[model samples]
Target chain A: MHSIILFAHGARDPEWARPLQRLREAVLARRPEADVRLAFLEFMTPSLPEAIDAAAAVGATDVAVVPVFLAQGGHVRRDVPAMLETACARHPALEIRLQPVLGEAQSVLDAMAEVVLAG
Target chain B: MHSIILFAHGARDPEWARPLQRLREAVLARRPEADVRLAFLEFMTPSLPEAIDAAAAVGATDVAVVPVFLAQGGHVRRDVPAMLETACARHPALEIRLQPVLGEAQSVLDAMAEVVLAG
Candidate 1:
């Protein structure tokens, strides 16, 4: 099975995860059986490594991490890669991949533009 | 005239602003005459206050601040509102309004979901 992890910069406020949860729901809506989860960087639960382990426990052989950030900053560029490297080392049997930050995607940019214009 | 500020959390790396720049470009494409600008919360030039000042100097009577964040955490809820209050106080003539974070928008959430599913 394949697992998709939505990596986000978590905040102290519990409600901050609302968007990430919605994103997870959206992903699951397309593939009901897909193993999708949300992981945080700080001030939240389920760090990236923990989330990956959870997926691995469920017989997931393929894991794709999508950073739900708007841009590739230090967090996306320096932080996530380092964590992924350790995750890869720990799960030799798992095929792990990192996708472009959501902000980098053209679709997301267009959507943000539309939101601003709608106002 | 109306000015739109695509406010984002900037990083130390200059390239980190690429996505925000793209967002600004997209907004301009929709409205060529739009006085759109990009401002950072930290580690970048043109802080929110500076952007608001510049807009006011350009004779913009209305300013809309759109935070490119995914959720309404402390940064979005407390920090931004505090800054906006100060900006409003600084420029009494300018009608400064804050919009929902980009991540809070349904279009953006859907786009993010589409991105993950496309893989």
Candidate 2:
């Protein structure tokens, strides 16, 4: 089975995860059977490695990690890859694909522009 | 004239602002004459106050500050309002409006879901 992990840079405030959670729900809403989960870079539960391990344990043969960040910064560019490498070593059979950050997507940017224009 | 300030949490990596810049360009593409600028919370130029001041100086009677964050963390819930308060005091004549964070918008969330599913 294939799984999708929505990775985000977590904040100290618990409420900070609300949007990330909403995004996961949005994904599941569209594809109810999709195995989607949330993982944080810091200050929250289920770090990248843990999320990957859980996915592997659940018989996920392939996993796509979607960074829920506005841009590709050091965390998205550096830290995430390092964590993925470690996860790969642990689960040699699981194929993990790192998708581009959400903000980098043109559709996401257009949506944001529309929101800004509407406000 | 009204100005739109896209506020983001800047990072040390200069490339971190590219998505934000694209969002600004996207806004301008739809409305060529619209006045839009980017401001950072930290690690970049044109802080929120500076952006607001520049807009006020450019004869913008109103300004819309859009937080390009995925969620309302302390930075958005607290820091931004404090910055806006200071800016309001500095530019009493310029009506400043703080829009909701981009990620909170339903359309943006749906767009993100689409991107996730496409990957």
TM-score of chain A of each: 0.97, 0.98
Top candidate on DockQ is 2
Judged by whole-model lDDT over C-alpha atoms, candidate 1 comes out at 0.92
Which parts of model 1 have CA positions greater than 4 angstroms off?
none
What digit string (tens of lDDT, one per residue) describes model 1 on residues A14-101?
9999989999998998899999999999999899999999999999999999998888888988999999999999999999999988
Top lDDT: which candidate number? 2
How much lDDT does each candidate structure score?
0.92, 0.94
Docking class of 1: high
Q: lDDT tens digits, residues A11-88, model 2?
A: 999999998889999999999988999999999989999999999999999999999999999998889999999999
Indicate the residue-level lDDT of A107 in model 2: 99
Candidate 2 lDDT over residue span B12-103, tens digit each: 99999999999999999999998999999999999999999899989999999999999999999999989989999998899999999999
